[model samples]
Structure formats: structure tokens, C-alpha cells
Target: MRLVTYRRSIEAEARLGVLVDDLVIDVATLGERAGSPLPSRMLDFIKLGPVAVSELGFLLKEAGGRWPVNGALPLAGVILLAPIPRPDKNVFGIGLNYIDHVAESAAALDTAPDLPKQPVIFSKPPTSVIAPGEPIVHRADITQQLDWEVELAAIIGTTAQRVTRENALSHVFGYTVLIDMSARDCRRAGQWIYSKGQDSYCPMGPCIVTADEIPDPQTLDLWLTVNGVEKQRNNTSHMLFKVDELIADISQGITLEPGDIIATGTPEGVGAGRNPQEWVWPGDVIEAEATGIGKLRHPVVAG
Candidate 1:
């Protein structure tokens, strides 16, 4: 099932719903009719886990036929919000996880930094998150070389620690699209915090598909286009360290709680990798998509 969060109006609070075809079924409305417990918000539904998810699926199936019955509101009238608007913690991101991306960065930096014998991990602040269709603030004054990195993000379903690669995927809730917006200028200064943590830099979700929907995570085709021009194109099969290894590696000591997101990194063809280099400016539109998962589009505006 595809789960979503949306707001009917600016003054309204975010609500939980299920996305079926082009319609959005308000879980609360269905729960009320089905005699199941109603969750106050999207986060509440997430906290309820698989049982709640199953109950929702059953309710929707029972509702049968068409959705958003007459007199009921249509999903088109509501503003689709990020599946998880504000994640509970930082978003884990892997760096240099694709061979081509690694090679490109190595040549661009010309600094041949240690080849991260293991997964090179970093994180983006939770405040940076913006939902699909939202505007990405282009901090013109702070950065002239704003760029984009399209990545595949995995959502954790349950708390986990010291997990083995053999069972790492069992801890995953699902997958979604993550745009790792970056400020190349800030990154050259030393740390990734300023480069990657700018407000509205991280754009994720339209919805979260349960792990079952994607039987194999390794074969998805991921791509990104800027102003209708393709920039990055690659398959998840090229990931230097696959999802299972990544989960096991990250969870070795630290605890991964439900709702925590881990961005599996981008492929080659970033703006910085171009001959003369290309960068995002105010008014530029970015669209990133992954197979099975969905698409995320955001416009660039002055910060």
C-alpha cells in the first residue's frame, strides 16, 4: 500500500491517507466506518506499524468500487505533503557509493582522498527536508554552485541495532526518492554540514511503498532531470555497497529507530561532473524519479 500525508488547506493539519491509483483515501474516514482505531496524524499511523497498515488495506478493499465517494472530498483538492514531513532524526547518506560517482569526485577534487575502504557515511539535518512539489531555496548569496544529487532512500520500519547483512532488509519499511541538494562552494570550505544542511536542501517522498511492493531493491532504474534535461541516469544494481550491507554497516553500534531514513547515495552525472559544470539557479526545476517508487519535482527559488 502507498501511504501519504496531505493537508486540505494551509490552516489544516496534516492527515494520513492511502494513495490508490489517482485517489487518496483518508484513513481516518475509512477507520471510522470500519470500526478500527483512528490515528490522529501520519506519524501516529506510522507508530502503529504493520497491523495498522493491514487494517487500512482491508478497509480500503472493503470500501470497494470508486474512492472519495460523492459528497466526499477528492484528493486533487488537497495539498500532498511529504509522507513523513519531519523525520525524527537526521537522514543518513552514503558518499561515493557508486563507482562512477566515486571516480568523478576523485578527479574533480584531484585530492585522491583515502578511497573510503568502507561506506563513507554522512547526514543531512531534518530541517532540510521538503516534500515533492515544494520549492528548494536557492541560497544565492551563500552559494553560486548549487547542485543536485538524486538518491534512493530507504525508510526504517522497526528499531534495529547490530543487525547482520543477512537480515538487514527485514528492518526496512520501504523506499522513496531523495534529492541531496548541495552547495558546492560550502563543501569546498571543509565540512558537509553547510554544503548539505541548508534549509530545503533535502526533498523526499510523494509516498512510501511498503517493502513488499518492491521485491528486489537492487534492480530499480533511477534518474534525474533538470529543466527537462537528463543529468543522472543509472541503476541501483551499480551500488558499490548494496542496501543490505549498508544497513548492517550503519546499524553496527548506533540504533536505527522507526521513521529514520537512509539515503543510499547517487549515481554518476552530477552537475559538477560536467565539462564546464552546470549549477542550479533560481527558477530551475528538478525532477527525480525511481522505478516502482515515484517521482519528486521541486522548483528552485531564492532563499
Candidate 2:
């Protein structure tokens, strides 16, 4: 099942939803009706692990493949929010993990083209995350060079510490599309938090496709576009450090808990790597997608 967090209006509380075709099934109410209540928040729901997932499957089967009119809302009628709207901690990110992206950065930023022996990890504050259809804030006073990176985000379902690479994927709950927005000029002394961690810098969601549906995340296709023009396109197969390696490496000492997200590095063709070097300015729209996860579209707006 494709899971989501959504609200019917600005004043409504965000609720957990399961996508069934073009409809959003209210998971909480559905469970309540089945005499097995479920959490309304995505994070809380994720913490329940496979049992909750199994229950959802049972509920769907019990429904006989049909939902009452009031039980499921039209996908267009709800405001889709970030699956985990506010992570307990910062969002983990991998940098320069795509071979071609590293090469492009070398040419554009005057850096060496050598691939790193280990994964380069970074963090983005929770505030940077925004939902689909939200505006990506462009602070003119702070940055004139805004860039975009289309990445596949992995959400952890179980606690992981010192996990082996072979067993790493079992800890993942699902996958979603995440656009890493950057202020190219804000980097200082090689640190990226200032450039990539500002509010609304992350545009995530459409919905989280459970890991069960995407057995091999590496084979998926992903791409990004600006104002109807394609800019980045590549398969997850091109990633220099795959998802399993990332999860295993990250959990060596630090713990990865439920609802934690890891954004596997983006592929080549970012605005910063273009021949003429483009930037996303106010009024432009960015649309990015990963095969089964779906697309995220956000307008660029002045801060």
C-alpha cells in the first residue's frame, strides 16, 4: 500500500492515509471500524512496524476491495503533506554519491573529479521539509544561485545499529521522492547545512511506496524537470554508493530509528551542472519523480 499524511483543510489535523487507486483511505477510521485502531500520525504508525503493515493488508482484504463513500476521500480533495511532517531529528543525506554528479561538480565548481572511498553524509534540519504542491522559498537577499537535486528518500521502519550490508534493506519501511533544494552560494568552508538546510528546502512526497512493492530500489528510474523542461534523468542503478551500503555505514555507531529518512544522493544533470549553469528563480516550477513513488511539483516563490 502507498501511505501518506494529509489534511482536508488548513485547520484540520494531518492524518494517515492509504492510497487505493485515486482514493485516499483514512487508515485510522478504517482500523477503528475494524476494532483495531491505528495511529493517525505517520511517524507513530511507522513505529508499529510490520504488524501494522500486515493489519493494513488484512483490512484491505476484509473490505472486499471496496470502500464506502465516506471512508475514502478523493485524492484531489485532500492536501498531501510530507509523510513524516516533522522527523524527530534532522534528515540524513548522502552527498556526491552519483559518479556523474561528482564529475559535473568537478567541472562546475573547480573541484577534483575523484570519487570518494566512503559515503559522504550530511544532515538537513527538519524544518527544511515541505509537502508536495508547496512553494520552495527563494530568499533573494541570501541566495541568487538556487539549485535542485532529485533524490530517492528511504524511510526506516525498525531500529538499526551495527547492521550488516546484507541485512540493511530489511530495516527500511518505504521510499518516496525528495527534491534537495540548495542555495549554491551559501556554502561556507565546505559545510552544506547553511546552503541546504533552510526552511522549505526539501520538497518530499506524493506518497511512500512500501519497500515490499519495490524489492530492488536500485532498478528504479528517477528524473526532474523545471518549468516543463527536463533537467535530470537517471536510474537509481547509477548511484555510486547504493542504499544498503548507506544504511549499513550510517548505523555503524549511530542509531537509525523508525520514521528516520535517508536521502540517497541525486544523479547527474542538476542546474549547477548544466552547460550554461542554470538556477531556479521565483515563478519557476520543479517536478520530480521516482518510478513507483510518484511525482512532487512545487513552485518557486520569493521569501
Candidate 3:
């Protein structure tokens, strides 16, 4: 099941729905039709625990056999929000997890690409999130050296602390594509927060695919593109640290709660590493895609 949070208009409240064949079936409407309305928000649904998964499982099973489409809405008619817009906590991030990305970043800095013995943790505030199709504000004055990072975001299904790598996957709800849109100015000033936490800096979610669907998160292929030109092409398999390790590492002292988001580090090929640099310009379309999850496309607009 590809779960989504959406709305009819800018003023409308976010609603939960399941995406099927480019259409969205409001879970509330589906529940009403089934005489049992499911949770109405993405976080609420995820918090429902296995019940939500079971509900989605039933829906997917029914659809596979022959969908009982009664109140489905065309996907084109609604606004897609980050699966959990206004996330309860800041988004946890890992920097330079991919070997090649580490190498490239080091090269750009004219330093050795020594791998981090541990994950390089960072965070992006909730305000950074923007929905797919929304424009990524190109802060020309603040940073013409804007960049893009296509990543696979893990949606936590339940609270986890001191979890072992072996059981890490059990806590995963699913995955979605997140483009870690960046501004380079503040990063050079050693202020990653301002560089990454700007409004509309994180473009996420076409929809969240259940963890059950992705057998091995590390096997997934993900990439980023500028307009129609493919620049980053790498697989999760290339990461020096895999998903399970990240989960266990992150949850060691900090508790990961349901609805929390963790974006695994991005792979090689970013604007900063390019020979002459390929910063974003207004009107450029950026796209992030992962094999099983989905694609996230947004245009850059002058801010």
C-alpha cells in the first residue's frame, strides 16, 4: 500500500488516503464504505500499530483480487503533503554514508575521503518539508549554489531505543523518496542547520510504501536528476552503513518514535562535486526516484 496525506485545497485539512493506479482512495471514505472508517491522518494511522498495516494489507489484497473502488479520487486533483507533514520531531539525517559521496565531498574540500567511523548525524527541522509538485525555492541571493540529494526516507513504525541491528527492520513502517534540497552558503560557514533547514528545502513523498514490500532496504536503487539530466545514480547497496545499522546507531541513546522520519544518506553525484559546479537555477525541475518507493519531482522557482 502506498499511503499518502493530502488535501483538496490549501485551506483544507490533511487527510489520509491510499494511492492506487494514480488514484487516491480516502481511507475515511473507504472506511465509511466498509462501515469502518480508518485513521484519518498519516501519523494517527501509523500510531494505530499493526492494525493500520493490516487494514492496508486488506485493501491491497482486495485491490489485487479486484478493487472495490467506490470513492476513489484521481491523484491529479489533490495536493500531496509529506507523508507526515509537521512531523512530531525534526528529521534525522546521515551525511556521507555512501563511500563515493564521501570521496567526492572530500575531493571538493581538497581533503582525504576518510570514512566516518560512525554515521554523521544531522537534522532538518519540520519547516523544511514541501510536498511533491511544490516548487523548491531557489534562494538566489542567499545561495546560488543550491544542491539536490535524492534519498530513501524511512518512516518509523514504533518506538525503538537500544534496538539491535537484527531487529531494526521490524520497527520500520515503510519508505519514501526524499530530496534533501540544499543551499551551500551556510554549510561553508559551518552552519548546516541554516543550509538545510530553510523552508521548502526538503521535498518528500509521492507516498509511503509498506516495509513489508521492500525485502531488503539496501538493495534498492535511488537517484537524482536536474531537469531531465541524470546526475546521481547509485544504489543503497553502496552505503558504508546500511539501514539496519543506521536504525540501531540512531536509537542507541535517542528514542525513535512512531511517525519519526530518518533519511538515509545520499549517494554520489551532487552539484558541489561537479567540475565547474552545477547549481540550481529558477525553472529547473529536480527529480528524486527510488526503485520501489516512487518518484518526487519539483521545480525550482526564484525566491
Candidate 4:
């Protein structure tokens, strides 16, 4: 099921729903119809865990296929929110996962800078998250070189610790599109945190696709376009360290709690790679998509 958090109107509170085709079946409404009351907020449902998902599935099945066609719920009238709008912790993102990206970044680094033998991980503050179609603040003064990175983000479903690769995927909730917006200048100034933690830098979601739907996570096609012009294009198969390894590696010492998101890095074609580089400016729009997941488009605006 493609689960979403949306508001019917700008002033209305956000509600959780499951999107089927063009229609959205409000989960709360369905629960009410079934003589039960569910928390209207997506965060509440997320906290409810597998029980909530199973209950929702039962409700949909009990509807006997009449619920979605009722036209009482209109998807076009709603405003979408980030699937898990305020994750419990900072988003963990891997840098240079794709071979091409690794090569490009290596070349850009000051000669033979002792790269981390393990995954170079960093965190993006939760405040950075914005929904698909939200505006990405382009801080022109703070950052002259703003770049886009289209990455596949894995959503953790349950708490995991010392999980082996064989059992790693079982802990995954699903996948979604993540645009790791970067400020090249700040990233070069010092550590990655400052550049990566800027507000509205991480734009995620159209909806979260349950892991069952995607049989193979590593085979998906991922791409990004800036104002209708294609930029980053590659497959998840190109990842230097696969999803399972990433999870196991990251969780070795640190515990990965529920709702933690891990962005599995981007492929080549970043603006900084171009001979005459191109950076995002005010009024620019970026659209990023991953197979089976969906699209995330955000407009860039001067801060």
C-alpha cells in the first residue's frame, strides 16, 4: 500500500491515508466506518506499528471494494506531507555510494586525503525534511554552489541491533525517494554536518511503498531532473555498499530505532562534476524519482 499523510485543506490537520491509483482512502474514515477510531495523525499511526498496518489492511478488505469508489475522499483536494514527517532521529546518509560518485568525489578531494575505509556517514537534521512539491530554500548568500543528489532512502520499520545481512531486510519498512540537497561551499568549509543540516535540505516522499511491493531493492532505476533537464541518472545496482551491508554496518555499535531513515547515496552527474558547473538557483525546480517508489519534486527559492 502507498501510505500518505495529507490535509484536505491548508488549515486542516494532517490525516493518514492509503493511496490507491488516483484515490486516497482516509484510514481514519475507514476506521470510523468499521466502528473503531484511529488517530487522525500519521505520526500516531507510525507509532502504532505493524498492528495499525494490519488493522488498516483488514478494514480495506472488509469494505468489500466499495470504500475507494465512494468518491467521498478526493485525493486531488489534499496536500501531502512527508510520509513520516518528523522522524525520531537525524537522517543517516551515505556519501559516495555509487562508484562513479566515489570516483568524482575522490578526484575532487585534495590528493589522496585518507578516505574512511568504512562508509562515510553523516546525519541530516530532521527539520531539513520537506514534503514532495515543497519549496527548497536556496540560500544564495550562504551557499553559491547548491547541488542536487537523487538517492533511494530506506525507512526502518523496527528496532535493529547487530542484524546480519541475511536478516537485515526484514527490518526495513519500505523505500522512498530522497533528494539530498547540498550546499557545496559549506561542505568544503569544514565537516559535512553544517552543509547537510540546513533547513529544508532533505526533501522526501510522495508515499512510502511497503517492502513487499519491491521484490529487489538494489535493481531499481533512479534519476533526477532540474527544471525538466536530466541530471543524475543511475541504478541502485551500482551502489558500492548495498542496502543490507549499510544497515548491518551502521547498526553494529549504534542502535537503529524505528522511524530512522538511511539515504543510500546518489549516483554521478552532480553539478560540481561539470567542467562549467551548474548549481541550483532561485526559481529552479528539481524532480527526483525511483522505480516503484514515486516522484519527489521541490521548487528552489532564494532564502
Candidate 5:
């Protein structure tokens, strides 16, 4: 199931829905019809755990995939917001999780090409998130080096702390596409918060695909394109620290809750690693995609 948070109009409240073919099936309305009302907020819905998905499935099957008039909308007619528009906490990020990305970054920064013994975790504040087709603010006055990193983000379904690698996948609810927008020149002594936590820096979600559909998160392909040109292209199989390890490793000290997102990191083809170092400027378009999850297209606009 492809879950989404959307609004029928600019003034309308965001609604929870499931994407089916070209339609958005309103989960709240569907649940109400089935006498098992669901939450309208993504976070609340996610907190319902695996049983919520199973219940939704039963409701869908009962309807024979045909939703009532008020319970469905054409996909194009609604504004697709970030699934979990305002994450309960900062979105966790893994840096240099891809071996090739680490090598390229080291070469660009003139450092040793060393692999991290564990996940290098960072974060983007909740305020940084924007929806699909939203504008990525290019604050030229703040920093001129705007960069993009396409990532596959895992959404946690349950509270997890000190879990083992073998049981980490059980805590995941689903996956979504996330773009880690960075301001390269704004790095302050190697800390990424100022460089990556600016407003509108994280563009996430076309929709979240439930975990059951993608049993093996490592096998998916993810890629990014600037305007019409492909810049980053790779498979999740290339990640040095896979999804399960990341969850287990991070959970050792910090607790991960439902609605928490972990951006599993990007591949080698980022702007900073390019020979001439390309930067995203006003009027540029960035489209990022992960298999099973959909595409996120955002335009760069002057801030």
C-alpha cells in the first residue's frame, strides 16, 4: 500500500489516504465506512502499528477496491504533502554510508579514503521538510553552494531501542524518497546542522510504500536528476551499512519512535564530488526517485 498525506485544496486540511492506481483513497473516510475509523494524521495512523495496515487491507478488499464517491479523489487533483509533513522529531541522516560516496567526498575534501566503522548519523530539523513539487529555497545570501542528495528513507512503525540487527526490520513501517538538500559552503567546522537544517532543505515523499510490499529494502534502485540530466544513480545494495544495521546501531543509544525517519544516505554522484562542482541555483528542478516509492520533484527558487 502506498500511503500519503494530501489536501484537496490549498485551504483544506491535510488528509490521510492510500494511493491506488491513479486515485487517492481516503483512509479516514474508508475506515469510517467500515465502522473502524482511522486517524487523519500520518503520525497517528502510523502509531496504529501493523494491525492498522492489515485492517486497511481488509477494508479495501471488502470494497472490492472501489471506494465510495466521497472516499476517493483523482491523484492529480490533490496537493501531495510530505508523508508525515512535520516529523515528530528531526529526520536522522546517515552520511557517507555508500563506499563510493565516501571515496568521492574524501577526494573532494583532500582527506583519507576511510570507511566508517559504524553509521555516521546526522539530522535535518523538522522545519526543513517540504512536500513533493514544493520549492527548495536557494538562499544565496546564506550560502551559494546548494547541493542535493537523493536518499531512501525508512519510517519507523514502533518504538525501538537497543534492538538487534536481525529484529530491526520488524520496526519499519514503510519507505519513502527523501532529498537531503545541503548548503555546502555553510558547513561550520564539519557540523552539518547549519548546512542541512535550513528551512525547506528536505524534500520528501511522493508517497510511502508499506514495508510488506518491499521485504528486502536493500534491493531497490534510487536515482536523482537535476532538470533533465541524471546526476546520481545507484542501488541500495551498494550501501556500506544496510538499513537493518543502521536501525540497530542507532537504537543502541537513542530510541527510535513511530513516525521517525532514517534517510539511508546517498550515492557518489553529488554536486560537491563533481569535477567542476555543480550547484543548484534558482530555476533548477530536482527529481529524486526510489523503486516502490514514487518520485519527488521540487524546483529551486530564490529565497
Candidate 6:
């Protein structure tokens, strides 16, 4: 069952939704009829543990047939929001997780070591997140160069601390696609905070696909395109530190809670790594896609 966060209007309350076919089921409305009202917010519902997820699975099965369809709407009827619109903490990201990407970045920096000793982790403030189809505001005033990164984002289903690699997969709730928009000029100065923390720097989600559906996260295909031209394309199998290892490594000291997003880094085709160097300009429409998880599109606009 695919889970979502959405609303009918900007001022309308954000509610939990489940996508079945082309329909978005209002879990809260359905729950009310069953006398077991589910939480309106996706994060709150996720905090309820696996039982809630299990119940959602059952709901998805019975939805169109016996369940009330009053609150259900076609996918185009409502506004889709980020799976976790308001993340509890900064979103975690891994840099140079792909071997080819590491080589490219190293070459650009005139450095050595095709691969890093450990995963390079950084944080993107929650406010950087924007919904799919939303505009990724280009920070043109302060940044002369803007870049795009298409990455697969992992969502934590439960609290995890010092988790072993063997048990890390079980802690994952689902997966979503995140476009990690970057300001290359600001990033070259060192700290990735200001470079990546700009408003709408992260365009995330069409919806979250449950982890049960993905037996092996590393085998999926991911791609990104700007305007009508393809830019980045690769499989997750190339990741130096796969999903399980990334989770275990990150949880070694920090506790990962439900709804926490982890972008597993991008592959080698970023614009910044090109021979002549390329950056996105205002009015560019970018689309990022991952097999099974679906696609995310964002339009670039001057800040």
C-alpha cells in the first residue's frame, strides 16, 4: 500500500492518504466510519507503529469494494504534499555514495581516493523540502551555479539506535524520490548547510512505497532529466554503502525516528561534473524517477 500526505486546499488540514490505483483514500475519513479514527497527519499515523501500517494494508485491499468512497478522490482532485511535510529533524544525505560519482567529484576537486573511507553525511534542513511539481526556487542572487541531484530517499518506520546491519532493513518504512537541488557555487566554499538548505531545495515525493514491496533496494533503477534531455541515469546497485549498511552506520550514534528521510546520494551524471560545467537556469523543468517508487518533477525559478 502506498501512503501519502495531502490536502484539498492550502488552508485545509493535511491528512493521511493511501493511493490505490488512481484514487487517494482518506484514511481519516474511512477510520471514522469504522470507529477507529486514524491520525490525520502521516507522521502521527506512522508513530503508531507496525499495527497501523498493517491496518492500512488491510484498508487498501477493501477500499473500493466495501469501504465508503465518500472521502476518496481521483489523484487529480487534491493537492499532494511531501510524505513528511514537516520533518522532525534535518534530512540526512550521503555524499559520494556511488563509486562512479566519487570518482567524478574527486576529479573535479583534483583529489585522490576514488572511494571514501566511510559514507559522507550531511544535513538539509526540513524547510528545504517542497512537494512534487512545486517550483524549486533558484537562489540566483547569491549563487551563480545551481545543480540537480536525483536520489532515492529512505523513510524510517521505527526508532533505531545502534542498529546492526542485519536488522537495519526491517527499520525502514518505505522509499520516496528526492530531488536534492544544490547551489554549486555556495557549496564550493565548504559548508553544505547554506548551499543545500535554501527554500525548496528538496523536491520530494509523489508518495511513499512500503518497504515490503522492495525486496532489494539496491537493485532499483534511478534517472533524472532536465527539460527534455536526460542527465543522470544509474542503478542503486552501484552504491558503495548499500541501504542496510547506510542505516546501520548512521544509527551508530544518532537515533533515527519514524518519518526521518535519508537521501542515498546521486550517481555520476550531475551537471557540475560535466567537462564544460553545466547548471540549471530559470524556467527549466526537471524530472527525477526511480523504478517502482515513481517520478518527481520540479520547475526552476529565480529566487
**Each prediction's number of clashing residue pairs:** 0, 0, 0, 0, 0, 0
Residues 21-50 of candidate 1: C-alpha lDDT, one tens digit per residue? 777777787777667767857667766777
lDDT digits (tens) for residues 34-114 of candidate 2: 898889889998999999999998998899867745779999999999998998989999999999999998898665689
Model 4: lDDT to the true structure: 0.85
**What are the models' TM-scores?**
0.94, 0.98, 0.94, 0.93, 0.98, 0.96
lDDT of 3 at 293: 79
What TM-score does structure 6 among the candidates reach?
A: 0.96
Report the Cα RMSD per candidate. 1.9, 1.0, 2.0, 2.1, 0.9, 1.4
User: In model 6, where is the ten-residue run with the lowest total lDDT?
Assistant: 60-69
Candidate 4 local Cα displacement, residue 96, angstroms: 1.0
Q: Largest lDDT belongs to which candidate?
A: 5
Instruction: Give me the displacement of residue 218 in model 6, in angstroms.
Output: 0.8
For candidate 5, what is the lDDT?
0.94
Rank by TM-score, highest first. Answer: 5, 2, 6, 1, 3, 4
Candidate 4 positional error at 50, Å: 2.8
Q: After superposition, how far is residue 293 of candidate 4 from its true place, in Å?
A: 1.4
Q: What are the runs in model 2 whose C-alpha is more than 4 Å off? A: none
Error of 1 at 6 (Å): 0.4
Local distance difference test values of all predictions, in order: 0.85, 0.93, 0.86, 0.85, 0.94, 0.87
Clashing pairs in 4: none
